[model samples]
Target: MTGTPRPRTVLLTGASGVVGRSILREPTALRLLAATHSAPAPEADGRRIRCDLTADRLGLEKEEYTALAGEVDAVIHSAGLTEWGLPAERYRPINIEGTRRVIEFARHAGATVHFMSTAFVAALAETAPVALSEGNMCRNYISSKWEAERLLRDSGIPHTVFRPTNLVGDSATGWTSKGQIVQLMSDWICRGRAPFLPAHAGIRMDFVPQDLLSKAVLRAIEQDVSEGEFWVTYGAEAMDMDASLRVLAKHAAYLGRDLTIPPVVDPDTLTAEQLAGLRPMVRNYVAVLRDVSEVTRCSGGVLPSSMPELRTRFGVPLVDDATAYLRSLEYASAHLS
Candidate 1:
């Protein structure tokens, strides 16, 4: 880190979620109060406490809540419903109102918030080549995070936003607590399950090692940084479609599985009738992929990024994209299969 991590106590919300779990994996000097959803986290690597983000004082007793506010200097707000393709309303309770609750607590505690937002919000940029469709799977999720960021800003609470793209695994060992989208989709596609890859031409496939984000956040806390928006993504350094597909092919070979790499189909060229003709299951997956393409295209085919800053400032490892992606695929095949 920048210095011997300045000791500071932090209330880490969503301590049981993927991002939260990843954060706990990193070594840090900050004192942590891990707020979880239900059952206690035996391996939270910090003190664990059950919490309800939608409730007043996060469901803690008033006296206890006041005490908690006095105990922490900052909050790492990582908890949220991150699943895509859900109805817009499904996001309101957690992504919106839960954030509202966090804001209330931050205000009371005079604590700075280090909010985990999404890089997909780049789709809302003014230079976007196309509008993000309401039908897009990620639209609702991205919109919810955008609203949450605005809430923090309007609340006048001291905060910093870390907007990360899709996460894969650790940069070195490629270990993830659970399977992520890249692994799931790579497995299916490598097995020749996909009829065609519906992705926008020239769009970079941006996925980051989960640990990079964790390191950045911890460094921010150690340094007592109370403001700034960081995009923890590889912009120009990200792999293009061809390289992504090549990795799939390599993985298939490694597994001794026959692979017929699917043809890349432009999302715009695919007719509705053609999409409708696939089997119900295939159609669903294809539609989601196509919609995700719409998300990338809307962001001018490249999401906003802050990789250089992250590396220079926070010492996030500069693992090459293809190398990390391949390692993640190999790790999945070996363990997660």
Candidate 2:
């Protein structure tokens, strides 16, 4: 990795985010500038800069913006609103417009960008088994990212786009800066709170360990990958619904608790009476789970993957998927709960 010429100083936007923290933890020799909103980042001791994505020049003074532009030749564009279920308008100012600002800054800095996009964008595909409505939980968020990717593509800037599925934890130690949606949803299921698994048939549950994603990005940076699109997902190698439930059962045994694996229910089959029978909160949770399952099922029954490319091109280790997930669950049980 050291033999290749890489960027001297790299600007890391969203330095306080989960992916950003994982990147900070990864071994790297490049000097990194942590561009954050307001929260102090790991690099806050020296290279952290506060910025507003909605503001021009990231809300930095003219001199500071110029100084930053001069210092970096590469950017890890990881910043954006990732929360699901928000209105379309809520995502515009941050995810879409903020990316536009980042593109402007990159243009000024003459820096190549490595963007972090979500695999959930597949949900909006015309080939999806289930059609997604405007009110679908993450439709707007996914669309926003898709638009941002389009912006970078049209800008004629040298950039790489990585569409990662839901991230879990480190492959070895299962460490995460915070619990991601994968962990939270797994917890809810394993704790026997999920009345039934609301998912599409044959849809694989794809969740990649965060560190692998971090390694992929850093290696792409180190190798000076000029232009490419990669899906950092497990695809067919990912666990199926039955396998996922078995992992939960294993996790329960590890915790000295017995768990009943919930029956899988296709949301489309549920009648109004059955839907009304669920408590309001459970109904909402089920709806979210169902929508997420549909999202996972978008590109046919399985999501598209770039795992083989990641390993061959970037030297990412192919750790067992279920093992990584169990380690994550164990870590959350011990540390993050």
- What's the lDDT for all of these models? 0.88, 0.88
lDDT of 2 at 265: 88
Q: How many clashes does each candidate structure show, in the order listed?
A: 0, 0
lDDT of 2 by residue, 265-314 (tens): 88779888887899997887788888788787666768889999999999
Residue 183, model 1: Cα distance from true site in angstroms: 1.2
Per-residue CA lDDT of model 1 for 58-101, tens digit only, reads 88999989998887899999999998989989998899999999
What lDDT does model 2 reach? Answer: 0.88
Candidate 2 least-lDDT 10 residues: 38-47
TM-score of 2: 0.95
Clashing pairs in 2: none
